[model samples]
Target: MELWERKLKECFGSAVVDKPKAINNEMPGLPRYVSEYLLGFFCEGEITKENLKETNDYIHEHRIDAREKEVFKKDLLLKGSLKLIDKFKVKINLTKKKEDTIQMEIPSLGISDAKVSSDILQSNDRLLIDGLWGMGEIVYNEDNKQIQLEKFKPFQLSEIDLEELIEMREQFSSDQWLNIMVSTVGLNYENYNRRQKLILLSRLIPMVENNIFMMEFGRPGTGKTYAYENISSYSRVISGSQVTEAQLFYNLTTKQDGLLVQYDVLLFDEIDKIKKTGIDEKVKNKLYQYLASGKFDRGEVEKVSECGIMMVGNLPPGGFSEEELLERLLHSSITHSAFLDRLAGVVPGWELESLKDRRKAYTKHYGFAADYFSEIIHKLRKKNYNYILNRISLEGTTIRDADAINKIISGMIKLVYPNGELTDEELKEIVDIAISYRQFVINQNFMINKDPELKRTISYLIYE
Candidate 1:
């Protein structure tokens, strides 16, 4: 094992695992967190061939593919009852007057309207929200032709000590902690230089902070979407060209809250293509409003959410300047100065290396288990580090610019020094990166609009 891996294991113990070996390529449909949880449970200690085979066999038997829905249903009918591992959610049918209105959706088995007992619902309240992934037992009532969920056991980590996680930061130096974070996200720390690593870490600012609007555009296959998709279940990735205000904010017809209210982070991947589907002016206006102040109004409903927004896309392979790349890659609706100014930071994804060869880019060392790491990030969002901003001064920056820079600094501190501990030099380094990120947006806005007002210099000073 590597030195860093040994240190991580010594500190975190069972919370860490061999990240590369946690998933089997053959079992492709399961999410990274689910795969890691099962792997960690079955293949404890040194993962051997026997353990791997046993894990794979269990997954194959329990994981029901959409294509195998009919087969599983047939078996359930013959056996009178079935127990399987799947994600199931409860939907209360307000329209139904009967007591059997509490329905369960077993997504994997393609079964909707399965009756769920009130006891199960009380035990797993999460089922009413985004649902829970775990073992579920379903029995068929032949007379009524209804399926009932009798039992459930969630696989996700139910409770985490945020204080303990914060305390653990004291065990490593800043550099070592940075490397450990990089590895936690499944990247090989040794493969990236310091600057490149910072750029990668910037992708996580949204995860650690709330209502942070950011964008990253660069070459393809850079693992832009991989981290957001696999790192946490609280984040949702929308890749297609079309995005509606109703889907993002509130749906009037369904009277339901949208993605922004449901997740910690909403990542819009392939942003360049979103313009092709045509985002109308109304949607753009609503998006800008929400980005500015985490609140949106639709008809009679007005709600506030803390979900962060991240936009990511690929720049066509060429020698175009950064200004030209921004012009071509940004969605048409958000190209104006007003929309650009709301962004807290803009990551230069071009600086990061590609993940074309998984063997070369992915980490082989021990790192935090996916579910555990995700929970830590989710919990970190509740921490307030804006108080640290009082020690720094910004010159010649507008309110928006200062707010944007402060958020980045706060997020950086939260990620690196969650225990609220840092040196003067460390604070300076974080401030410099934060300013540069916000400056990139300012520079791009000036280049596109040629507005003299956007060209102001933003500098920061740390006060002892």
Candidate 2:
């Protein structure tokens, strides 16, 4: 009976009609707008001239202004349509003409010539973004913007932090602009705020050719898995205990029974739980090498896909002193420095603590559409990693000295940067997290190895 409902029935007939009905009858009721978006998505390419006319009439019946109707239609055509699936949501995109208006002189199968429409293919929010641009755009003028954009190229790297992101957004009011522009590009604003936006941006910015960045943190219930489970159609999560290298690197071709194919993100849950003893060292080494350099060979077809390797793990028990935890980890069978170095970023998971009050978890507004953030991330990956880092570091401290201390601190510094790029201020923050993590590790190690360097320094341990 609604505008989108009529349009959907006209375009897709009983199929979509059943969908909403089924939602009400068998599942939770979807918001009207969300349902309408799904209806538009279902009949995306299948829309015909007759259906369009019906849809136009339905829009008028619903008092949808011609201008607004045009905008929504434009979004539908350009950005594909929004679909709701179990747990996750998907936004598909159609090819778009990047202009304010699109003029078609040729006649379609039935439509007449001289058809003019607005060019609204993708959500402005989901527009192809270079993460470095967001950071540099906030700091320098337009001239420097171009300079930074050109200097950075997408690659495997980490990013800066949430507090600094808030500061940047505060300094320039670009957060509002981002919300406006990016939403028009096809993202939902309800799913993100500046803090989470920055965190997601940092994790995704340097992701480039054959890149793998793993984030394993101590915070247990901050909804890290929730985002991956519900967002972006391009990703999937696999339990570490169940995964095999074949599933990760390649799948089997059922017909010939060889490896099938690879994916964009191979997220391994409980990575710390995998059985390491039985697997051959050769296979382990190969897996490590592939993750580090992004290469593997099978006769003539050298499969080189831009796959991102993400592993999430919780820190050991808190009862052990920081030094004890580190010592226990060191005594473990894991051995591979290159893999450790390739860790582009490390999120402080413990920061995302579970609310002591269970009622806080019941709020409707707590969860966000992960795909929206994922799409934003997909766009940020277009920018250069190093360039973004340099631009951000302009105001922050630079680690000219990457001593063991510096190297340790750099990981935290990278978390606050746009793409592992830090400013002096960002460096200080990074230095703090690094020092904390290092202190934890060092104290634990002292108990295991009796090393003096493991002692926490007055400067390293920040006193409140």
Candidate 3:
């Protein structure tokens, strides 16, 4: 192993960091959190071939038997439930109090109502009820269909201790922290140059920020969709073809809040797949309105959800340079410049290094483990790194550039300085990468639209 990998192994260890199929997207059709919790809790903190096999064998040997179905018919059956904990979209129930009943969707099992306690609802964001099954109030109920939850514990990631967090923040240097973060997200620091690494981290920035919007357009095989899909359970990625207002904002059919309310990061993969008019004008307007200010109404319900939105698409590299591509895109109605302008930063997708080029890279050291780093990023969203941007003084820049600078700086806060501590020089290093992202959004628009007036507004966006 290289010195850094060896040092990381010694420092973090397998106990603190374990590979799970969930966070890596090695498993399909299940949420990342669900798979990770099962792996960590059941697989004994190792993700090797031997550990996985042994764990699977053990589970089959001890799982609930089919014969027990009769025994689970009476009393408060301790059945399965999916709880969003304190996190949820509200349903206005005139007859019942807000805390009394919440819907839990189990794929194999049917949805059930639990007469829940405030304590039970406040425990975790999402959980899979496990081990044994019973009926109402922990016993089998023949007549009542409701399942009462009796026992539960939050995963190591969802739970936090203030003293321990402060201690860890003080214990590690920023570089060490960055290296750990990279490895934890399943990347090897040895394989990437600084630029590739930054771009990789950029894909994750959406997950760590609230209400931030980003767009990345490039050729296929650049890992844009792969990055968003595997990173966290809180992300909801969809192909743009089937999107509708009901799906994006609220589902009139299900009488439920849409994807935005359920997830922390909403990713639209291959946006070019959706026709220009396929997205209703109302839906598009609502999205940009919420992007500008975090408020929207679905049916009779008006609510606010904090999530970062990411849009990805492919553009042919050879047909036209970005300058001409922008003109073609604007005129064709594939996407309007007005809608594109809503994005905080537009990623220059061609700049990212492809996964095929970096396939040989692997990390020898352990990081924070996949799920733990995800939870850490979620917690960091509550922090304000605006102070770092406030310290910056720029000359002859429009307010849009200023906003871009702030949002990009906020991304750094979530990824690099989650503990809200960093030196000025360290902040500057992050700022250089951030400014480049902002510059792309501004320069591309000016070049495509020939907005001489707009060009003058972003004189400071250019970096030589």
Candidate 4:
């Protein structure tokens, strides 16, 4: 172990368990980026007998694989069960000759078909599985061998102890947590001010909000896409002037899930450049459906997704007001008033407004490693905090305005109070921040639709 690695471990705590290593590409089916982030030390580099001992510790250590993988099963006769996470296409068969069998396919591995018990299929639709995977050599291709199912256990977060989580969190002060949060996304926390922290946090909002639609348009160099691009394997950021419907939603030819289904955070960079003439009407409509219903239909497939959608683009350093941005979006981009109505919030990244920014030689604050932080957020997202919305007075607000407010509030609750415990002042702080973010959406919407009440709601949020 190196000195820097030791310091990183101490500062970040368990958030960065291991350093990044080169990814193993020979392993098919599993997402390599995810494996590298979560299990990089073991999965990276060449396979060796000495390193295989670490793999054998699966017996002693309780940690399990939590990403997609191409499991090359060695023995078809093994009966023991193992846990793993991956996408499997399932089908049912109830032939009297056997109890029952469910067919599963890992298309990425060229495993066209395999069988699992009905128990595995019970929580089938929620593909974010955490269960034991039984391994068997069921079939063989030209070079790669197909794996068989021995057993599986779908993972879920049961009831949590609020006190225990709070006790654990108590070790760090608010400043420490804030620094850790920023550092987790690969930035030095001390380098940013309070406004910059909000900008950085805006990137984490997707993990906090359920299918929240967010956008940040600013001058190109403001690091708008920095966190989204480097922070997590759960996110995918696509940049282009012309985005096709099949590419984003679904592919009709291959029947493959698009970016919406595959990633937790789906970012469309250079959204300002996505011209109306360059986009297909169907792609635009599918985006609308995804925004409106948290899912989209492509022929026979209707994917229920929890993806947080974000749009990013370049804006001038000055002279662009909310009203002007609304007009520009309508004329230059595929997004319309109907589409704009579905956004949960908008971030004003240009507000950071630093002319002479400098990077520190080393990080002063320790934060969660990108992989560890991603998992912490993944779990935090499961918490319920809708009750916090009751704290807000919704008088004279439209339904969309109220819903947007709740979405942002929900984000803050998860970010600040993941343990489901907080003081009234703490709660107010979260709500006030949530309001400030959602107010941008309300004000933007008002500019487009000319909603007077919506415009006033922004003022109310800032004043109240």
RMSD of candidate 2 to the truth, in angstroms, is 16.9
lDDT of each: 0.83, 0.36, 0.59, 0.57
Could you tell which candidate, 2 or 4, scores higher by TM-score?
4
**Model 4 regions more than 4 Å off:** 1-13, 17-167, 275-278, 317-319, 329-335, 353-364, 451-455, 458-464
- CA-only RMSD, every prediction: 1.9, 16.9, 5.7, 7.8
Candidate 2 lDDT for residue 263:
41
Note the clash tally of each candidate: 0, 45, 18, 10
lDDT of 1: 0.83
Angstrom error of the Cα, residue 226, model 2: value is 1.8
Q: Candidate 4 residues 1-464, lDDT tens each?
A: 43444554654443453322222221233333343343435533334555545644532232323332234232222423333344455543444235334446654344545665445456444432222222222333323333454454322222334444445565555555565566555455566776577566766788656688888877766667766765555677787656776778777775566777777777878877654444566777787888888888989888888889888877744568665674574333344556766877778776754324434412444344444555566666677775655656755566776787677777766665565566676666666666677776666666667756556654233222
| Deviating ranges (above 4 Å) for candidate 3 | 1-15, 18-34, 42-51, 58-101, 112-119, 125-140, 145-150, 153-158, 161-176, 252-255, 275-278, 317-320, 326-337, 357-364, 419-425, 457-464
| Model 2, span 1-464: residue lDDT tens | 43433433443232232322212221123222233333343334344456545544433333223345455434434544311121111122223344312222111111111221122212221112111101100011233221101111111112323333324333223344334322222233335655444444333322322354555445455455543443343455776545454544443331111111334565656654543433345445656666555676443445665666566665665533333332333224332333343454445454445434433432221111222334444444443343332332221211311223343333223323333433455455545544443344334444554555434442532221
> Ranking under TM-score, best-scoring first?
1, 3, 4, 2
Among these predicted structures, which one has the highest TM-score?
1
- Per-residue accuracy of model 3 over 301-408 as CA lDDT, tens digit each: 786988788878777556557655544433233244555566677676777555565444444455665555556676767767665566776565667567766777
